[model samples]
Target: MTKPPPTTRPVITPSRVVAGVCLVLPFVAMLWVGSYARVTPALLGIPFFYWYQMAWVIVSAGLTSTAYLLVRREERARKGDGR
Candidate 1:
């Protein structure tokens, strides 16, 4: 009996790498507490620590959206579905 062909693995292209970075950056920034563990740099009376996290909420959304788009585009290209 002939052996079955091996399953194809997903290619790790540059666009995928950028998507991964986008997804990971927010977690890295938030987890690195020491970076924003301050009170001086206030934004409209909000402390740096608080404001920084709040700002990341918006940034994270954009980054996540970008990552999603990149991955989707890559997948479409792989499937030869240029849309």
Candidate 2:
């Protein structure tokens, strides 16, 4: 019987490290910023303490998207997408 061919999965690369950092840093920043702003006053009409957390909703989305894109690119490259 013929043996199955060996898989050619791409090894972990620098992009993976970047993606991991992108995923983790924003979350850590969000936590620290939220805590630091906890006792601050309002800005314009919005509360200072509230804005950081609220802004993180958008920032988190951006960070997540960046991470996803990086991971997808890495996967595609691994699959020999000619990157």
Best by lDDT: 1
Best by TM-score: 1
Q: What TM-score, to 2 decimals, does candidate 1 have?
A: 0.88
TM-score of each: 0.88, 0.70
Error of 1 at 9 (Å): 1.9
1-83 per-residue lDDT for model 1 (tens digits): 99998887777899999999999999999999999999978999999999999999999999999999999988888779632
Model 2 weakest 10-residue run by lDDT = 31-40
Model 1 clashes, total count: 0
Candidate 1 stretches with Cα past 4 Å from truth are 1-5, 81-83
- Per-residue accuracy of model 2 over 1-83 as CA lDDT, tens digit each: 99998787656788888888888987688668547565457766787777867777898888889989999977787679653
For model 2, what is the C-alpha lDDT against the true structure?
A: 0.78
At residue 41, what lDDT does model 2 achieve? 74
Which pairs of residues have clashing backbones in candidate 2?
A: none
